[model samples]
Target: MTAFILVAGAHTGGWVWRQVAAGLRDSGARAYEVTLTGMDGGGGAAEPGVDLQTHIEELVRLIDRIEGQDVVLVGHCYGIHPVRGAADRRPGRISRIVHVDVGVPEDGDPALKLVPDQTDRERVLSLARENGAGTLPAPTVQEWQRWGSVAGLPDDALARLTEQAVPQPLPTLTQPLRLSGAVAEVPTTGVLCTANGSSIAVVEAMVGLGDPAFQALADPRVTFFELETGHWPMLSAPRELVNVLLRAAAGKGHRVAAVREQPTHLRPFLMDVEERPRERTGRVDLHLPDADGPRPAVVFVHGGPVPAGARPTPRDWPAFVGYAQYAANLGAVGVTVDHRLHELTAYGRAADDIAEAIELVRADPRVDGERVALWFVSAGGLLAADWLAAPPSWLRCVAASYPILAPLPGWGLAGGRFRPAAAVRGAGRLPIVLTRVGLERPEIAVTVEEFVSAAADCGAALEVIDVPLGHHGFETVDPTDASRDAVRRAVRSVLGHLRVGTD
Candidate 1:
């Protein structure tokens, strides 16, 4: 019989996995819910010296005692640190390693780095030091959202989780996990919790960014499953978690394609147009029209969460260059910009960069300050929300191509700051153009549909150009006549809007 070892995240012990353990047992599998050292019912405050290594040793001993049985080790959130350390040590004995809603950290990476927010990390460290203890207290019930989304949890579950939670050892978060590289050979499964802001689509996007760090995710030995609940699926959807675990153990889950030598965005643009000379000014590049006397301008915003070290940034990309040149040929000044949208959390900084770029473009002697259109693509689409919320008179039109109108679940964006769908209600009299593809990812397509519905409900002047057989980056990926025609139509529509007040 196959034996499963379940490890919970910080502050909680084996007790958190009670329902999951019982569910696995009902399926004729042996389940062991582990409470790491220093956690409640697992030596607790008595083991003040408990660190990451101590937790790893605890799991290693359990795996050693389960003689002659196939072991599948499961780790949730912070528990992944020790689970990976243990798996690295016993790769030959482990059948599969299941990672629940957390990224697999590299050797020497501390759990403290996984917190994401710098403020929260400092707060955690301060709390541990001020308490005069070596432990960080669990977040209160009111503060639970800071840890992760509590979308599917019931009132009872929330209260129970808060009541049963214990202070976490400081060493576990600060101490790094040591790996000998053996765990890379072990089959791996990733259970992504979509409601908590992680989804396979996001993983695919990361891989598409041409980052070497994300390339390993395409390995055949690794697979993925997505849960529609928040972080704690054991409490919110135990039965579903059990079912997914069973399927994962059987090596049946979604497989992400390997990164191609050339990512879709890097492919050549669909439209063919004559090249125009571009004048580089700071971060913005201006492609001026031949017969220009203060020509109307179109600012092309590229998609991101791009790596900080990416070569030949967005402004120099083939599609951006192609669109810029095409606009210049159409008697309009084409502008492309480079912004520091290096991560999902850097949207605010990117927005500021775009705003600065626009101001510079408007001030240029070769561009018309009164007439301008904003064109956003892919992930950059969320940046359009600000302009749509309260468009200035100088802003003639806004256009998006395969845009993410709403934030994805795991992004953790608060309020309507970057949500274009919510801001569409305030887009009175502003001409908005949207280009959508048929073969887009479900997660992104849903956001597009939501924005469309909201625009209709609010009676916003929204124009949608549908590419029925195209993919997300269809301008490059699907370089058919349809793709070229769609691009031409979108450019024409935006240029038409720019000319409305001028003529």
Candidate 2:
């Protein structure tokens, strides 16, 4: 029989895993819910000075006690630190390490590094200092949503979570996880919470970035399962979480393919259009038509939270260049601009960058300021929300290709921010041309479908060109005749809305 050790995240304890533990036990597996040091599983004050090392020792003791059985260690969020540290020390005792909606930290990495945003990390540290007890207080009921998504949780469950939360020891966040590289040989499973801002697609995209730190994630022993819930799956969907755990123990989950020699975005564009002469202006690149007269401009927006040091930036990518050149050949100005969306939380900054780029494009002497269209690609789709909600007279149309129209479940975006599916209701007469692919990732396809349904409900002027045989980044990845034809149709439709020849 397989034995499981479940560790809960920050501010919580074994109580949080009650339902999941019960479900696992019902399935004939032995489940052990651990209440880490510095946390309270019952109505009692937390122990002081309980650092990450304390938690690791506790887990190691538990693993040693469980003899003659295969052990699977499950870690969620902050719990991953101790679980990983313990696994590293007792690799032979651990059959598999299951990571739930958490990052894989390397040697000397702290839990604070998982926060991603520097400002947020600083705020957390500040809060810990304010306590004067070497502990960070639990988030208030209202603040819980900011810590991790509260989606799918009932009001009572949320209330219980808030009331039962315990202060986290500061050392747990500051102490670096020490590893001996022994755990690297152990099989691993990643349970991605799609609603909480993680998915298999996101993992694949990161691996494709050629970052050596993430290369290990593409290993054959590392598999993945996606849960369509928030960070606290044990609370929001216990039964489902239990099932995934069981499957993960059997080494039966989706396997991520090895990264290709060339990344998908860097591949050649499907259409073989000739390059046009372009002028560079800061981050913006302008491809002007030979006709010389002021022409309608199509500003192409590339999607990302791309790395700042990525070579040849988005504007210089072959697909963006091809799209720009194709538009220029059709008697229009093709514009591509690079923005600083280096982190998922930087969408606001990205939106501002795009707005600034548009103003610069409109002010260009070779472009007609009154006739402009915005073509958004990939994750850049959310940036169109503001324009769709309140379009300017000069904005002729909007276009998106395999775009993420709604914020994924755990992105923690403001409720009213960058929600194109909801904003499409107010689009009025502004035209929208969406190019969707059949093989798109489920998480992204859901957003596109949501936007389409909303547009239909509002009777908005929306046109969808389906590429049944294509995939995400189809312009480069699925270079079939269908992909090429869809791209051509989309360009013509956007230009038609711009009234390029009619003017």
Candidate 3:
């Protein structure tokens, strides 16, 4: 299967990739537009806190589930910074790099810190602050003129851009790119955008400074191209951009234009007092949305339930970090805390630990005390289901994946997991479940079966989906069909259920 993963620049989301995606499909390639975190409108905005690593995690997640062995990655504007890191994570996963109106000029260092000293990028922060902690519209042509002349955009084109502009989350501009080993090894090409040459900080500066890193891709693994067009290629020149992308997909380089839309966090974090503690320490990384409106918070429990504060080996794998970032991107505070032997030795005692954490977060004004959700991975799902049994008003939704029906009469197991026979009698909304068992692991078959039985007995709405994947670990990465369907529904359902709590 041929896959094309397209991403937008700052001030835009995956929605902008729609028409171009359609065009690509009509031309016979499977294409997907990705809306990176901090871009979408409903999710709100970042705090003085959002950074580059956060943005990269979101993009890598989109790259994870792509069906083809390797995809042609197309990133525009600052998006190139993050996708390059993603390419670093999986050397062969992305076969080609298409930088629309973006170019490496040089490898120098990771692009994370390659920022402009001018006000062009900083203006977004002022806009977001004025708008109350959310994305603001991109500068209009009239607005762009305030900085410098946009060398080439003509009349009608420049006029139409103003109404369509949206504000960008400040982090995308401020965050510097973080490089992984995969990035250093991947083959890449840059499609330098110069239509509005005078307005581009990098392009206009190139006359004297040369490439940012000085012919960074001079090694055997890189190439370059220059395109003359306005920044919004999808809208300004969809056909031109599509044709450019098609060539890149075919292993060449080109530039394109497009249009798009664009995207938070604090804490009452100290309340979870562990009395019957295990030999482990827990760290809760809560990302509070920035606003007075009632927002939701998510508790992230990894699938393997690894030790607390231990980050996955990001440099070695493509699936690390994105899990927790998912919740943060959605304007929900994310608490990826660690529970030790308590979660393993005593199930009930372990669960209350999470409950206390919820109440602690509710102490914050940003979270609507009544509209919080809990999101868990494989084994974590079992624990979350059990905890939600007597959930507080704030614990509004539950999203569990590949959960066990019962290990020991509703027990969560590190070993022999068969769906628990437990029942959650709470009136909380139905859970969104994503489960997949290895074709060879029959217990995987019963994983969802057991969850279904418990949901029916519990009297809650349950959206359960099964997949043909060989292992239970697929949901954490970019998801396949069965897994994505379940996760997408679960995310939507959890958001909806949280609303119910607010009511």
Candidate 4:
């Protein structure tokens, strides 16, 4: 039987999950409402000397006991600390993680570090020191009602909660969560309380913009669900919360890019192509059109130069595969490859990886060996600038989207810095098409526009599609109607260019 481990938030114990755990058990699953050492009762002798490490070890010990069985670990509110720490230590033990109305922590993040209300935080800490012997006490019943934590609860339920809630260990709130990327591979679901009417994109964009603490929400592996209730869904909407957790456990809420989901019009034309037949540079899923003769192939390079030693996930495959499938459906061999990012500071090896991928894709019997095009996204466009400067006999055109076209501080390269603007001066006459998001990233938008202007000055037949309403990484992060339309038009234009010689 599968199991669900329910971890409660600050000033809470396993008692908070009583209804939720019972609901899970009634639904044919084993459930455990975990209480950290000091948070077990209203007031206990074991309430002293507890820290974040103690809480993390408690969950880890539970996982070790339940080894060899499928488990879904859930974290609510401040419980995200222990759950994330345990997940990082034993990622394989848990099949999925459900974050119920809580924020995920980044490596070395402590509680309240991301909180903006300094006065409120200080008040809570002062109250803990004064009343609970260095422990942060639970909010009063009236305070819970006023703060909306008990918004939809009945009077008796509210009273029970306030009576049972215990003081949280102060160390747990102050200790940093130590972690590595191991837990990053774990699939996470964010069950958001949307009674405030906040969408996932809006919330994530706000948090990701400046705060490194809320930055973990941007991880592609995270799938989101919104419930129309206040903060404490376990108390306010347990049944609905359970349903969402079950869906997440069954992997139903994710928006993954699988090859079979291609549109009907594109289905018959699409065929999966492996970009590298015998290399460890990572595989790219190529979707090629089914044509009678060899067709022009477009080698698609995706945006990321991921940090050193990070494992790639299926979330990383979607946007590029989507574009490749779109290109394939329109009569071209669309190749998408995950080129190697040599080091965090350099990308010369990425160039070699792309060159190898292009050659591998071009050599395929279904692809016309003499005709090829280049499609690059984000930083990939800058990496492909070398090829753009020295056009091959077979290379027809190049298309780039929201690309980082110039090198700035921090984005170091091998041998020398990334200077795409300079590279464009020598790019003889290769026709280039660029799609610029209106809500471009502050770091590279100006440089990209300057590069485009420089390329046009150097006599390259350049076309710029300006999507003023689109934001940086909109193709993947926030694919608006306008952004999708822009992509369709760009793909058609590039395919048209590639078909010139063959037609």
Q: Put down candidate 2 lDDT per residue, 289-328, tens digits, no spaces.
A: 8886789999999998787766768998889999999999
Clashing pairs in 4: none
- Model 1 residue 196 distance off true place after TM-score fit, in angstroms: 4.0
Candidate 1 segments exceeding 4 Å error:
41-47, 116-122, 125-163, 166-171, 178-182, 250-252, 309-312, 425-428, 449-459, 479-483, 500-503
Candidate 2 lDDT for residue 96: 97
lDDT of 1: 0.88
- Give candidate 4 misplaced runs (Cα > 4 Å): 42-46, 114-116, 124-133, 145-149, 201-220, 254-503
TM-scores, all candidates, are 0.85, 0.84, 0.42, 0.48
In what order do the candidates fall by TM-score, top score first?
1, 2, 4, 3
Model 1 over residues 148-261: C-alpha lDDT tens digits?
778799999999999899888888888888899999899999999987778897788677766778878888888999998888999999999999998888888988888767
| lDDT tens digits by residue: candidate 4, 1-503 | 67999998877888878888888888898899988888876563336667888899999999999856589899987888889899999998888899886666888888755332344466656755665446765768865532333446667777888888876777788778999778988989888775422346445433432334444555556678877666688888889888888888887664422222332212221223333222222455567575668888887776554443333422144566666766676778777777675333336677877888788877778788788889888777778668766778888888888887765432323222356776777667777778888887555676787887888788877888888888666665555677777877787778778873347
**Per-model tally of clashing residue pairs:** 2, 4, 34, 0
lDDT of each: 0.88, 0.88, 0.53, 0.70
TM-score of 2: 0.84
lDDT (tens digit, per residue) of candidate 3 on 1-503: 66888877665667667778898998898898887665555433354444556666766777787666758888876678767767777667888877765554223343322222124434455664565344445666656443222435556656654544455665555444555455666666666444433122232222212222333444445555555555556666677677777776565642221111100001111122112211112345555443357567666654332333323211111221334344445555555555442223344444666666666767766566766677766555656655555555556666665554444211213332222445455535645544445442333345566656666886766665555563444543324566555555555566666553334
* Candidate 3 structure, TM-score to reference: 0.42
lDDT score for residue 160 of model 2: 94
